[model samples]
Target: MTGANGVPEGFVPLPTSAFVEHLGGLYHAPEAPEHTFGMRVGPEHANVRGRAHGGFLATAVDVATSRGARAAMGDGSGVSTVTMTMDYLAPVDVGEWIQLVTTVDRVGGRTVFATCRVTAGDRLVARGSVVLARIRPRA
Candidate 1:
């Protein structure tokens, strides 16, 4: 099922900062844990070259995979990216709805490792991996 704006049915808009809100609305897919994050590409997301900017895509991946890692922490803990790498496979055009499909590779006491594939429809547009440091509350 899909939403009115073509967003998938299970996805709900995620509250974000002004910068992210301007980039494009972020979505959380609660029903599909693997597909925890998503966003729709708009003309504003395009670069001067008329494709989705690499920086924007990188930001989306970082946010999405960090959410995956945080969920793996299993204590409602937050996470900060320790390191991240992204490989651009294809150019995503405006009007494409992209999904960030993530896998939690490993979970440890202080760190989590995860990978995400950015897909636009049937195309795999990018892949990213991240190592996140668990952010525990100061006690």
Candidate 2:
């Protein structure tokens, strides 16, 4: 199945083991029109207070937004996050799966704007916007 934008539906951007193995660094983008992704927060990702680290939350949003933009551009395009702004609304506990939902707000010749939300279960943990620049393939 394809999303309204025509990308394959239910496609995971990363494999399950990829998230499990990475511990502190893992992300998955499940296929959707909203361009959703998620990461499992492990003990290593927690802060001194034992909650998910703010940096990890930001990283998850950045990665999810970048991948979502790339998916919107289709195969063979490379994109990187040029800027990201995140708001922490709530704390994310360790051992919980944080879902990142991204939407391609705009796509221009060389730039893509995206918005993402991070949630643990039904609670909003963080939200952000990412500006990505498309880079030409290396020669």
Candidate 3:
């Protein structure tokens, strides 16, 4: 079930998030399944200038960071991104395969912090960090 870039079929490891699906973002799951995710830039994900939009990039950042936090904390309850900061290093053109490498920085009582480095092959796309709050377990 490998795709053009060798990503397995239905690679998106996380739950079917509305926004992530809207962006056509998917990840490499059942393989690494942690701390890393990827997406192929599509027309819908592009801005008027035919490049990746800031919102799309930011959403990818949030998604990857959240997944990383979940992997590190091993809490299936869920992770809510509280805050995020992104710095666009370069523009990603359409049809490029982008990968986000995320790391969980720390886990507090309820907050988890993580960072991600985005790249398209060898090109830097953006760098970002996010803080996520662990969802409480339901009774």
Q: Flag regions of model 3 displaced more than 4 Å.
A: 1-15, 29-34
The top-ranked prediction according to TM-score is: 1
lDDT winner among the candidates?
1
**Would you list the clashing residue pairs of candidate 1?**
none
How do the residues 1-139 of candidate 3 rate in per-residue lDDT, one tens digit apiece? 4576655465654565887776774675546554678888888889999999999989888888887777777756579988999999999998787888888888887888899999988888899988899885777
Root-mean-square deviation of candidate 2? 6.4
Native-structure RMSD, model 1: 1.7
Give lDDT tens digits, candidate 1, residues 9-128: 889998866877878778988888475789988888889988899988999998888777766666778888999999999999988889998899988878889999999989999999
- Range of the 10 consecutive residues with the lowest summed lDDT in candidate 1: 67-76
lDDT of 1: 0.86
Q: How high is each candidate's TM-score?
A: 0.90, 0.79, 0.84
Clashes, model 1: 0
Which of the two candidates, 1 or 3, achieves a greater lDDT against the reference?
1
Candidate 1, residue 86: Cα displacement in angstroms equals 0.6
